[model samples]
Target: MAEALIKKHSRTKLDMTQGPIMKLVILFALPIIASNVLQQFYTIMDTLIIGNFCGATSIAAIGTSSQPVEVFMCVFMGIGGGVSILVSMHTGSKDDESLRKTVKTSVSFTYITAIPLAVLGIILTPVILRFMNVPDDTWDLAVLYIRIVFVGLLGNMGYNMNAGVLRGLGDSSSTLLFLIISSVTNIVLDLLFVAGFGMDVAGAAIATIIAMYLSWFSSVIYIIRKYPHIEFSFLPKGIDRESLKNILKLGLPLGFNNSLYTVGHILLQTLINLQGSAFMAGASVAGKIMGVSSVAISSFSQAMSTFAGQNFGARDYGRLKKGGRIVPLYSALITMSLGIVMYIFAPQLVGFFTKDGMAIKYALLCVHIQIPFQWCFCVLNTILNLANGIGAVRYSTVVNLLMLWAVRIPSAYLIATFWDGHYVTGGVSISFVFGMLAALLFYRSSHWARICRA
Candidate 1:
């Protein structure tokens, strides 16, 4: 009966194989765009609460506190990426059992790892902030916020993996629903905890943690109930060593690549810290604002990965190429337009974080300089996602990692050291240029296409 259910809803039977590339790409990409953007909205709400009610010090504290968490979150997301590609391949092959096993194992692994990490994070909050050179003024708030969020790492990991699994199954709508709920919950809690209770940045962080857990639990329950294809025995049963090994192999590089990429940002954050608390606070707000652009383009990136993985599994190179071209062109246009809108409204937008004139001016500068380069990254990411989908792991891993350390880090160091009056702004803009160029070079290479066909 279960087998019959699987057959009835098999991917091939859905007839996704023969669509116009643009339509198919849009179909796959839009829900992801909605979900990803909404996630940024949740973070924005957290910032807004802290910035408005708790003050700029709180905003800076929360923002600075979030970097390591973001690093860990990226790794968790990378693990989900490994699971997603596996599921996408199995999905295209009409192997429902493999999907179920992958889902179970990945979920189990996430839970096991996240809980311990969260505990460690809670214990290490002060130590981390001290290393980051968080100012004495912001240290208390930063430690409070980071510790709260650290304790909730399981929820964060669960949400990421849940959404990744849904994406793998070509079901982005469910993920969107969860993000909507979480964003709404986050905003309401932000207001209640920070504004009403006067709990400050810690309150905002706590609110975010509550919403995250709620979203994760809701997604897990819904998937178990609605997606019978994914529900299965939780216990380890005749574990597939090959599948497990593949996931580890893919996940570790993907996770390490993500971490290494963030390492450059981590270093940049250190540099920004040197400029004083006001600059650090302004940079934090600007970076959060930039996360808005990624919402749309990153959605396309996720879709490209899933589409490529599925088509690759079916050995459908035509569909893969079609996807590669369509997603980049579409996402680039959408994100570029949004970036322009954000740039135009930069003064009004930055004011939400602080009333300080200098902070607002620097924030606008960051916006103007970063947006065009961000547009270029839309193209870069699509190609990279496609590479991941087709199991071109080494190439994608190498491209992103090298760009961060070799091009981005070195360029930032040189610019900041030699360029008089250039500041963090110059260092960041130059780094973006180098990273974007590296991505384009990799995308243009024949090797990526060959890997897709492999």
Candidate 2:
């Protein structure tokens, strides 16, 4: 029955298993890279508009709000990652029956997980903020932003699930349209709510929430028009047994890792909070600047994973081996090029976020410590994506855990306690070196090498 439905399949624009590795990877990565830029641009606009209109305290509020939101969002991101991996493999093998089931189960999983998490997030927002040691100045704004955003969490998770299906089946460009529309919607609403009506951080949150639903709805309409086999629904058909098993097999570890990973970050955020609101606002600004600079690392990671997943599924070991080596190096070079540009223009870029002198000072301090070594992240990220593409995730999960628990958290605390707290950004940079070294071992002893040989 499921196989019969797949007879209406629409072939992906680029088949991963058949192409020049470099050309195909770049073609596929370009849209994803562009989408990342749009993400950063809107993010910057959020801070720029808020900092200008609402003051530095609001920017600090947003910075505080983000990690709590990420804690809720990352678990579903892992589910999306797992869905894409399975879809790529199933597509590569031309297993239509399993592919259909995976798509169905993905919708069910999203519906099941998202609402409960969202409710939990909203209810716990104040307590969570307090636990993070959010000072009185930024506390109320953080509570308001987080709760409003949580209202749209279901739409955001559903959109990701839909996008994951397309990406897994080798369609990367379509989501770019979704992002553009969302970006436009967000900016326009920001002008109306924040600028015109003076809604402050509340306005920014509302604007982003509306865009989230629009991205999900637009993705649904596109899927229905182009690939009718995919019908994205908030109310799913009863969970398919085989698909549930497959999803859990990959999804659970990845989901737990993502959730825990964000929790680890929340601890780091606590360290940042202790530095005061001016430093918090500055670090937030630096993140936006460096986010754009480091986009290539993440963009290529997604592209490489899809490419590797499809090839691995098709038993095209040659491309897998080749891409694993080539893509990471390309990503590193691109990252460094952007990092150099950001490093040169740091003051101007940081200034673009706000006029506050103290915030600019601390933002530059954070950027100087972090941006120079972003190339290391590129290498580590692409390597793990290679492993993810091939459905060999345990080692990568372990690597991430070790980097956070063993390296980042301890180092961050020690640097703040013993050394100049201004230099604490060095903690993440130090972990990058550690993570890169650990990721390299995936190629050395992992079953991916054995799978390639077999």
User: Best by TM-score, which number?
Assistant: 2
What TM-score do all the candidates reach, one by one?
A: 0.92, 0.97
Residue 19 local lDDT, model 2: 73
lDDT of candidate 2 vs native? 0.88
Candidate 1: C-alpha lDDT: 0.75
| Total backbone clashes of candidate 2, pairs 3 or more residues apart or in separate chains | 0
Give candidate 2 regions above 4 Å deviation: 1-12, 230-234
**Model 1 over residues 1-454: C-alpha lDDT tens digits?**
8777665544422223456766766777777777767877777777777776777778778767767786667676678899888988887877877887788788678766898888877887777667777788888888888888887788888878887877787777777788788889889988998899999977788888888898888888777665676674333244466667878877777887788877667777767666667777788778878888667778888878888888888888867766776677888888788888887887788888787676676677667767767777777777788778888777777777766777766766776677732255555556555555666665567765574555
Backbone clashes under 3 angstroms, per model? 0, 0
